[model samples]
Target chain A: MARREVSVLFFLALLCKAIAIRSQPSTIDASFCLSWRLAVETNNELPWRTVPNKCSQYVEDYLIHGQYERDLELIMEQALDYVNGISIVGDGKDAWILDVDDTCISNIYYYKSKNYGCDPYDPAAFRAWAMRGWCTAVPPILKLFNKLIDNEFKVILLTGRDKEILGQVTIDNLHNQGFIGYERLIMRTNIYKGQSAVTYKSNIRKNLEDEGYRIWGNVGDQWSDLQGYSFGNRTFKLPNPMYFVP
Target chain B: MARREVSVLFFLALLCKAIAIRSQPSTIDASFCLSWRLAVETNNELPWRTVPNKCSQYVEDYLIHGQYERDLELIMEQALDYVNGISIVGDGKDAWILDVDDTCISNIYYYKSKNYGCDPYDPAAFRAWAMRGWCTAVPPILKLFNKLIDNEFKVILLTGRDKEILGQVTIDNLHNQGFIGYERLIMRTNIYKGQSAVTYKSNIRKNLEDEGYRIWGNVGDQWSDLQGYSFGNRTFKLPNPMYFVP
Candidate 1:
């Protein structure tokens, strides 16, 4: 009876080890956690693609969602703390700031470029995207945004998406996503266009001071999204280990 | 006589061609002439390094006075226009914003990483500079800063230099540099500290708003100095091309 019990324990350990090996690619590391959304969207071969494989694998069942979500929450919380702590507008201070694409809408199709994301750079395809549908809201962020809005905060959706693709599409997307209460949707243009992501975003922030609505809090996946007010030109940087392919 | 005249003309033409080729590098491209100052001082090298060889050579001439000063006057006028025309500060009505250090001081030495100009990152050296002992002002900008101050509605000196450094060294440096009657000195660390440049400088801007200040202009050398208000993380920016070796 003792030998039988030991054999069962040995089988469970082996099963656990196998599950871990199959759920995550060996190359996946810490930094990639931040950009995982984009990564998974862009990579068809990503472990999540095989639904049954994921569920059957104990590692994916126990690890993927919880670990990924926890890391994301921590970074977002840190970012929100930095944004909300700001008091730089009106008599009491605070301004509206936002990011285009993922923050305000769903452009996950671009991930199809790897199997998930569409490359917005391709003119005709980009135009199709711009002309086609409204952006969808990201799941986790909706509740927080509503909470802030309830507290009397204004919103701004600043994105690195080309100015050419903005205007109506952006407004439609914002409305479709239920990302209301925004005073402006800042986008990149040829006039102020330059390579440095720092200048692109922060310069816009400097300009946004015009309406006297200082950004109270900003949320987005790329580091540059929240910038315009901080370190400089980095985009929603959180970690992007998953998708540097593009 | 026609042959002689042709020979003489030919010789002059060769001289002219040779001069054009040799001096090509010293001629600042019209495009760069406009944005180089802000871009350069913001990161010190973004524009200068990007300048074609012809334009790059022009920097040395501008480094000195005389014909170079004339060239500088033209560029400064353009820089002022760039600042005023496109600047997004103080409800888009503020006059100008300027950065200290490499922007105002001719710290090509520190930039080059060899001369160890007025303020070296070295603790003792920086402490000594903080002594304020007859520190010389950066030359090219002396006339510019003074000119703006004399005509000032508002002249803000925004710098990413640490607050602790603002003590005697910074105060004395400002005094010696002949800067006075400024509304504010935007400094670093008034916000939060992160390993990246974005958060370091953004905090300073946030604190300013808390104090009821409206930033009209922003100027600095490193990207963090001017555009740090972007997303919250500092990217340890690539480098100041003019001085950064690593």
Candidate 2:
């Protein structure tokens, strides 16, 4: 009897291990895929102000106590300097480029814990999660974006997030947190359902540069945000402490 | 014989009368409708290069005489300046934010004569057209982009195009024009699909700025292009005298 009980326990443990391996979370991948889909399908309808499970604590620890706050502040200050730093000179005309995700909002825990990247998804459950829409910005970074809006400079939120989920979710999330209104929101999407995030984001940035908006500053957690077909400028990187890159 | 001749003459006069009220050629309606259909359905994929008609003449004449050389030079110059306008002085690093469309490639004629807006799309046609790989950039503009590449400024291209189509067409188009490499292609998907173009673009720009890219310059044509989430220092507007708001 004792041997049989041990054998049963061992079998269950082995099965659990297999499932865990298969379900390792990829917060960046899942969040990224969701955001891209939202951008193309939902048109940036993300509920902007849902307090993400990991948001408040992450802000207090990594952002407030971590180096990110100072890093972001320094970045913002330099960005605001215009000619001296980002070449943002004078009035409300100067434009600043900011990234969503890890830069402005917190989504890591939701993506990681839920194992959202493992595919085999339930659309209804995903929508349910999105409906919660309670996320906090990366401490000083959130405050900084508000500063840009208050200072009269154009504040634009460019992200790999999907446009489809941004409407009520994004507006509510941001407005609830006191994030000011933005002039525009550029979301990444899947034009053909199987495109790379790299190509989509890069091409769009090129087109934006071609349009003549003076990009005084750019902020993001990854390198993709700062690089465009014709424009490369001063960028601030907040230690994602989470994850990014291939 | 006189009666027969009179009948024939009368018939001919009646045919002429039936067509007299028309202001232009009989094919004008078919053509206008066709162009409008192409514009609306095909995402501006009308092959002007393949249409060996007066439209070709118009294109040739415009390029050869309508300040083509001068405007090209100015656009190129402005593009370079806009890319160079950003810098990071106070911090450890800086970045640039670039807008795509008229700033990177030449797509105005396609959009203008064809007549297209962000909305009012034909899904199947737009999807196919979006997949086309020969979407080339304006010659002089390419030259300027290439110059920026040579100067070693990190290049990023932000645009309103979807990310799904980024792989083949956007890359091939920019690459065929000559570029050492590009860092990012920030794109906008269907996010903010119903919002004003200004609001949409601004959101994307702000996201980049928050990421810490000291945007130097943003070069584009439309006012929305020049004024997005991130306002660059120098905005270069190329001449797009043909199109208007949708």
Candidate 3:
């Protein structure tokens, strides 16, 4: 073949190779992101700060799309089914532990601006967002909460939000979102500062148990919220591929 | 219109309605099955018997089509990364606990006949399958296993299999599949017969700890295999959407 022909052939070959390389990582990355999310959900993967850089789009789409809501719905259904099966003693001490962020209320609106947790967690920025008190109720959880109240079970809102800065706003947000009649709203006070989420939440739960309350059900979007001592009789983990609390 | 024409139109409407009704359940069922599997993997839902009757095809496809294996590969990768991070003491007591059935060897072929866990677990048939010792190694897990051995970590095969029935076959199968090198194999014996899987496995783990083995890592498909006392320094849960042990 002539030199020109050979050059053309080499160029075409390079283009094909380039296309192959370009197309490959997306598929591999997509699969890896999926597995990463599952591993995170099942608590196999831990202590992740932010979503994988490659999975930002995937995570964003999952959150905005119908799958996230459907997942939440299924969890709520299961939780309600479990609660219904229990014979509530009709005592005020039968309590349900619910995490505030991503459990009862969602910060997805704020996280949307942060690439759906692709950005590292900024404490000040997140606190600023929370201070706005603009977070909405997670619908399925709101439904479950009301059902628990209707069933005469005490509903406790337990969170890692700072009691000093976020206390009033958190209360206002909950009330605005129809999360009324909760038995208590517990937040991180000064004494629990700097403690890991697992330790802080566990200590609070221990206090509730100490007060003669039976925590029958616990629900949260983070594994840290569900793990540790006094983790309740049954715990439900809602999907949050966003960020790890610890 | 004539009566005959009216009848034809009515029949067509009825046929359309029938088709709509027939098509809707599958879509809903598919979503529910996906959520159900996730819930089971995350330990949100528990004590399930067989795969939901409507989800037979979904479960079968997940098991056979590459997704399940991909999930397994991700877990194995995470486990290896975790294992690599640990600084093993020169002492021979650094141990890795692994559950045998789905973690080391897969029962996919047997489950294929059982509708991918859509059928109720039949102990006699399953034991017969196990006795044949035709199980294949889960490739990712076997890789992790060999890597652990290479790293000088003591690998312990802790399983829920009956010692009297499956001891020799289990050993032969492991050897045939290249699971060689340093280890101990602990299986269920008479004393643990009546106990639940959590109790049984926990007891065995406690025994190993009492013997001065530090369980730096634990990997299992069933939650029961990983829960309870002496769970380990860190635990990795492999994907198992099949039957629940307890």
Candidate 4:
């Protein structure tokens, strides 16, 4: 009986060692993943197709945990503070620009199936998912949208989603998700087909200014959305570590 | 004896409860502080004075631990990769701009005493520290500097440090830290006394361009160092959550 007990203790020790060995790489990966996400968000690391395979679990945990929401909440608070300070011209030309996907509504559900963007982007799969219009409002951003409307700012919904395909469903999805009363829902037309997001968005913004719209604020999850000419007076970036548009 | 044992157990449970209660706020603060740091790093949260009091320990741990070094390593890796891809003109006009403080040399030793920037900025104290010239080379950045020098790229040290007060000491600090063979060390002069960092750096970059220097890469810890006119072909930001420059 004593021999059996000693063997059991030895087995337990081996098991602990195995568990430690298994966890050690992940522990290192987790720290590197955090740095990678920061680099992505800061636009230092750009033109990436997807999250690193090693960071799949890290990104999943970051999104599943309350940290993602908390980050958005802080951004929302700051945006509201900025808006409160704005003296709206009341000329019906005071505008605020918000990116659609991952800004107005979350693609978390879709990304969950895609390993939180660890898998390479499948455009057709994403289009099918968008056509389904299953995205829900990012709660704090929905609040920001409503606040913008209440403040009488012309909230333009600027997105890179193709107008020929996803436009109608996007409108329905946004309206269903409490993003009503927005001034315009602008999507990519065939004319802007091959242009990069920065070029496309910049030209659109230039047009808005040309039409006498005073863009007060811009909010986006992707840096491409906030960059380029006429990028408004203040730009707020929401966190989206899952993928990069440009 | 049983009564005494029961009393001791009750006391132990109360002690555990007290410890849990004491740790609860810090746990919450830790999560929020992480989000805060991410926001700051991404340039979403801006125009801040110092590190939040709640984030003091968080920032301290991030610096003291190996995470800060790992982050810098990743940035250095990316910067080197970018530098490798550049086609140098070989006309002695290829240049890279690097910010001095917190970029080429680290001020962690100084920030350590200042509660990792939880304390408010005391310009007099910071200037005194600068005058002492005790900063060390950020190892990865030093490597990048040497690489640029080896590649015959002119390394320009552009800093917001006052030229009249700390210029010589800054040069000595850089040299002692092995940051040798740089093209120029540009510091703030009295003429730019009241200008913001963005304006000051932009004007200098403009002057450099006017002088026939092709700015290929810019590296700095603060966004102000990378923003504004003539921001180079690429800009890399190193992590510094301790303080804000603009």
Candidate 5:
């Protein structure tokens, strides 16, 4: 019995040795992960409070390694494949919905200058940056958009920015940043004031579908952009750990 | 001057109203969202820190509305539909991987008694719960598992539980709770001690694929379960706002 147990233990040890997982730091530790998450939530929701100072270094490290950009590229690659595989079911009705901020253009420079959540979000400063029309295109998503356009898919730009106040600047920024020829640019209206993003985007998409547009792909960095009815055939979410919309 | 500025003033008023995106709790003002978030990260990563008391009511409210259950059901329903649609390419090597805890059996009863992160995690008490073999199955996931089995896809169980310490108990618990006839049940060994869930699960899944098993679908509550390569053709994530696992 002792000999048999030794053999079994030996075999098990071999199996365990063969299975070496966790070699890479694919997932961050608990404290680090939580800190990162809190940074995002505070940035998007509670912009008044500053993120903990200790977490700033970790956030910088994450961004420095280009983690967010890498994830976006991989996810958008899948998006490309998915869109490429689909057959457009109708004419001028095959539309792809794209969220504006963070989805197509990045505000990383602005966030970085603010110490990556260590500083409170300043709406006036953000508006100033928006008006400058200098934010760079999120390369991966921009590439995906170009492919969709190349494939004859109607591209619609949707955003939460004030259409009346920032509308012209927003358009100029997209055009300046290499995004062009979108089917339509839909911005928040007085009707959607104070409403949740899910409610606002859902209503708009439903209206577009009602107008004979078939949303083939919907991509966004926020859950509000993807969830709810009238969500396209497939929804691709790009990472934005820096903020949560709601 | 007043008459000349009338047009600009009217336009500005229209713009302000139109741009009112973040007005109605643009973010949930309650500290609950942050607290709830911290709780999940702590449970999965640190497991030592006590989640704040202020967020307990919010967590309770989320649980009371059956939000977690509802989300799981919806996600699993999607998984079921996705798995059903796939055309099996291999003889019998196609598999559906599942995480055991929270994904299959739920420890909600034990958690509710602990005030949902108000108290520090007690492993001894948790082990006692594990030994009882009474934790209920996450209903929707259980249903998904049954369908996968019925569909003849190889159903494999992977979990972060220690194989040496709780292997038999885990097996019995799964079997007792209506989960039966899985192709394999993999648990963490001494070799993977103190590793992140993402690293551990990723290596294991990669190994399974290396052994020629084609993973068709993966369902889990944590990002760690779904992020790595050799991931299933499709990944269905269940909602678990209560606790995160790596």
Candidate 6:
């Protein structure tokens, strides 16, 4: 009887270990996160893995336990300090570029089910999720944006989503989530279709500059959102190993 | 004794089955191939997988058995048919844009070592591989490029490789691989740094058009190489499931 009990316990232990491996975040923590950020900066993409992929247990814990929120608070505090340092030269011409997904809104719920980078991106499913328009505001960024608006800085929203398909819905989604009163909401048109996010966003900033707007700050979760020509005076990035947009 | 013998045979069979599963090609059949081609046409990325990945067993077999070459021959034949139907104008200003990697040269041997997309891209290793300058010609496209030149279509070579680092080496590599006599070889410059492949390439084509060159044909393995404003009259694409560039 004791031997049988032992066998049962062993089997249960093995099953628990398997579940733990699958459920744990795979890419979080200081060293791996640093390497990952560097790789992303250098234009290197990570391959999807069935086992121990990029998203880590710490990231899940961080999100669920409010550590992610704390990090954002700290980042926004720094951004505010920088904004305070700069003086506006033009009337309402000092603009700040903001990326939509994961910057202003949280996709944590969608990514929680997708196993981060383990599963391939399903566009139809992603579009369905987006259309639901239920994503909540990322509190820190929302606060910063509101602060910027109150301080008379022009806030411009940019995203890689198609203007023809997702434009109206995205606007509604943002407005419903408490993101309102922006200078312009730029979505990729057919002319800029197939452009890398960097190129599309960079060109838009250049156009804004040409129109005599002074870009003062830029912020996004992806480095692609920040790196490029005409990149404003300062840039802020949030952590996101859930998915990479090239 | 009989029970022990039976257990041993079952174990051996199970081991054999496991080996077969690991070695089998997953995604290289006709239907998947067609779907993959379509996905690549509309979007430019495919995440890596360990099991039944995008690269099919049929593709491996095709590459090894020279079926890939035969398929290329068939595709080039169609391209030739299309080219014959079109009329060229503008003196020596009629141009054909040719992408260097994959469309003009095969990185088959390099990819084979990395299990296709199973491994993440290694730039240091890739640069070392490229510096050897030993990549062979993708014979069918080479033939088409040469044919276009012979037909008085000014062939233009374009690549995403950085000019500061790989310019001379790439030129020599192309020349050594029998890819000679092009009207221009444009490599990405520091001025275009941080630009997406689409933007960098599209701007180059637009510049050529501005200079009075009429683009008649474009060919590449990546959609980013073909899609954008100021595109040529026609475009041809080759198959590549190995890696993606944004």
- Model 3, position A12, has a per-residue lDDT of 53
Location of the lowest summed lDDT over 10 successive residues in candidate 5 chain A: A39-48
Pairs that collide in candidate 5 are A40-A242, B40-B243, B40-B244
iRMS, model 2 (angstroms): 29.8
Q: Order the candidates by TM-score, highest first — what do you get?
A: 4, 3, 5, 6, 1, 2
Listed models, DockQ each: 0.01, 0.01, 0.22, 0.39, 0.02, 0.02
Error of 3 at B99 (Å): 0.2
Per-model lDDT: 0.46, 0.51, 0.87, 0.90, 0.72, 0.72
lDDT of 2 by residue, A95-180 (tens): 77777767787655554444323323344654565557776666667766877777666877776655676557866776676677
CAPRI verdict (incorrect, acceptable, medium, high) for model 6 = incorrect
Least lDDT summed over 10 consecutive residues: which range in candidate 1 chain A? A38-47
* Each model's iRMS: 29.1, 29.8, 12.4, 6.4, 26.1, 17.5
Per-residue lDDT of model 3, residues A172-237, tens digit only: 999999999999999989999999999999999999999999999999999899888999999999
Query: Which regions of candidate 5 are displaced past 4 Å?
Result: A1-31, A34-52, B1-246
Q: Pick out the ten consecutive residues of candidate 4 chain B with the lowest summed lDDT.
A: B17-26
Off by over 4 Å in 4: A1-26, B1-26
Residue B9 in candidate 1, Cα distance off native in Å: 99
Query: Which of candidates 1 and 5 is the stronger one according to TM-score?
Result: 5
The 10-residue segment with the lowest total lDDT in model 3 chain A: A17-26
When 2 and 5 are scored with lDDT, the better candidate is: 5
Q: Report the first chain's TM-score for all candidates.
A: 0.59, 0.58, 0.89, 0.90, 0.80, 0.80
DockQ of 3: 0.22
For candidate 2 chain A, the 10 contiguous residues with the lowest summed lDDT are: A38-47
Q: Write the per-residue lDDT of candidate 1 for residues A133-235, one digit (tens) a residue.
A: 6456665466456655655566566667677866777777667777777556777788766555556776777765664445545555454444335422212
